[model samples]
Target: MTDQYAVLGNPVTHSRSPFIHACFARQQHQRMEYRAIEAPLDGFESCVSQFLQGDGKGVNVTVPFKEQAWRLAACRTPRAELAGAVNTLWRDESGQLWGDNTDGIGLVTDLTQNVQVKLEGARILMLGAGGAVRGVIQPLLDAGCSQLFIANRTAEKAQLLVEQFAPLLPEGVLLQGGGYTSVPSDGEFDLIINGTSASLSGDLPPVNPVIVGAHTLCYDMMYSARPTAFCQWAITHQAARAVDGLGMLVEQAAEAFLCWRGVRPDTAPVISLLRQSLA
Candidate 1:
């Protein structure tokens, strides 16, 4: 029997997950169908329960539903536990649901493999302290960045993240957090990531433009057909590269596919196809 899978979110019609996963399934010769599911804002649990009861093999949870999925799972991977969010979910032979967060690995892979940005010894600045940022922190720290700074509008949220992840830092690495206005003025970062929702609203973070320099690489964890607000900000600041999250989205889907199918599909062509379609 062909497997059934889907991505669940509010306002999910705009999702590219179905297209991305279809490409993977086709490339890997897997017998599966992927679709988008828009769960009602307050009815996510009920919607997911119904889907699973109807023979759904797996599902990807997005936005506000990720934390709910984490709570719903019978078990979770270590990364998911650290993130306190779940993006991928599947059931075992015993019918127990398991959750995992593939966001961090996806972001790291896209930054190092796809974008060719060396994270080792790189000074990094990340915007936002929400679930998106939480999902990527441990992996970025593990990737060997020398210093990581997280800035958010509400300073306490960012500081909480710093406190939570500080113990995981490798020797010689530093992690700090504060309000956007508190971003250090002493030095520039090699990499800056916008994990905030600012791009969706076409608003830039209230950060100093000086944080971006000629050698800096800026990435927004949001993608669109046109340049994202953060991407435009990077360009305006003459940053070396301005990237949207298309690559990360595809890479994360590929990781989730691997988790479900035990096989990895090539992502470059899928990303290219999605890019062209977006255009």
Candidate 2:
């Protein structure tokens, strides 16, 4: 029988995961069936339990359910433990659930490999201190950025994140956090990553244009058919490049697929296909 997998989200119909995973299965010749599961807002645990009991091999958790899934897991990868959220889930031989968060590695891969942006020794600015931002901090630090600054509406939240991840910083790497208005003006950043949900509502973070220089790459962790507000803002500020999170989405899914199937599917073609579909 084909292995069964799915993506669980509250508003799951909008997820491109099933299609992306289908492409992976075909590329790797894996006998698998993937689908989108709309778990009720308060019914995530029960829904996941039912799926696993039905012989489901794995499922990608998203949005409000990631934290719940993290709590439900019998074991978690180091990254997932730091993130305090779980986006990928599967069962071990003993039927113990394992959880992992691929969002950070996905963002790092897309930026360094796909976009060819050098993260090492580069000054980076991350906007927002929510779960999306939390999931990526360790990986970004692991990438060897010389400086990483996080700015959020709630200054305390951003500070908390900085405190939480400070011990992981490598020598010579600086990590700071503050409110949007408190973003440093001493110098420009090489990269500015928008991890906020502002773009989903057509809003842009209150970052100063001075933070973006001609060589800065602005990345919004949100993708849409058209340019996102943050992308347009970056363009207007004359930044070097403004990219959406589509590549990150595909890359993260590829990582999850590898975890479940032990085969890494080539992501370039899948990214191209998804981009074309978006266009």
Candidate 3:
């Protein structure tokens, strides 16, 4: 039988993961079945356990279940440990369940490789302090970002991330967190990433244009056929580039594919195909 993989979440019907993975498997000539399984909010644990114990080879957890998946795993990679969540899971031959967070690496890979953004010595302003933001902080730091200031609606939540990630900061790198008003008056940024879901509702985060310069790249973690509100704002402010997270989504799935299949898929073609579909 072909190996099975899936993304498990509540409200998973909206996920593009199955289509993307199907593209990947086809492109690589691999025999695998990937799908999305919607588990009841309270039934994530049981659903995941049942899948892994039976015929499922691996699963990708999303949204509300990532934390629960993290807790349920018998072993976790360091990145997942720091993230306090898990987006990918598999069981080894010995039956030990393994968890990992590929979000950060996926984002970093997309920015550096696909978007051609420079991370070393770059000043970044990240909007949001939630789980999506948390999973990607360390990878950004590791990518040699000179400064990362996280802005959120609630200042304390942002500060907690700053304190928690302080130890992992590369020497001479600066990391700070605060409310929207606390964003530095510093002239402009090399990059600005919006991690909030405001775009799904056609709302833009309360960000000032002062943070975006002609050299800045504005990236929204949400993807749509039309420009997201945040991306529109960035373009209106004359930022160098305004893009969505479709590439990140494809790249992350590629990382998960590599984890389960032991071979990486070429993401450029998949990304192009996905963009065309969105259009």
User: Which residues of candidate 2, in runs, are more than 4 Å off?
Assistant: none
lDDT of each: 0.94, 0.94, 0.93
Q: What TM-score goes with each of the models?
A: 0.98, 0.99, 0.98
Per-model tally of clashing residue pairs:
0, 0, 0
Rank list by TM-score: 2, 3, 1
Q: Per-residue lDDT tens digits of candidate 2, residues 1-279? A: 778999999898999999899999999899999999999999999999899887699999998899999999999999999999999999988999999999999999999999999998999999999999999999999999999999999999999999999887889999999999989988889999999998878778888898889899999999999989999999999999999999999999999998999988999999999989878
CA deviation > 4 Å runs, candidate 1:
none
lDDT of 3 at 178: 97
Clashing pairs in 1: none
Candidate 3: which stretches are off by over 4 Å? none
Compose the digit string of candidate 1's lDDT tens values, residues 22-122: 99999999999999999999999888888887769999999779999999999999999999999999988899999999999999999999999999999
TM-score of 3: 0.98
> Local error of candidate 3 at 240, Å?
0.7
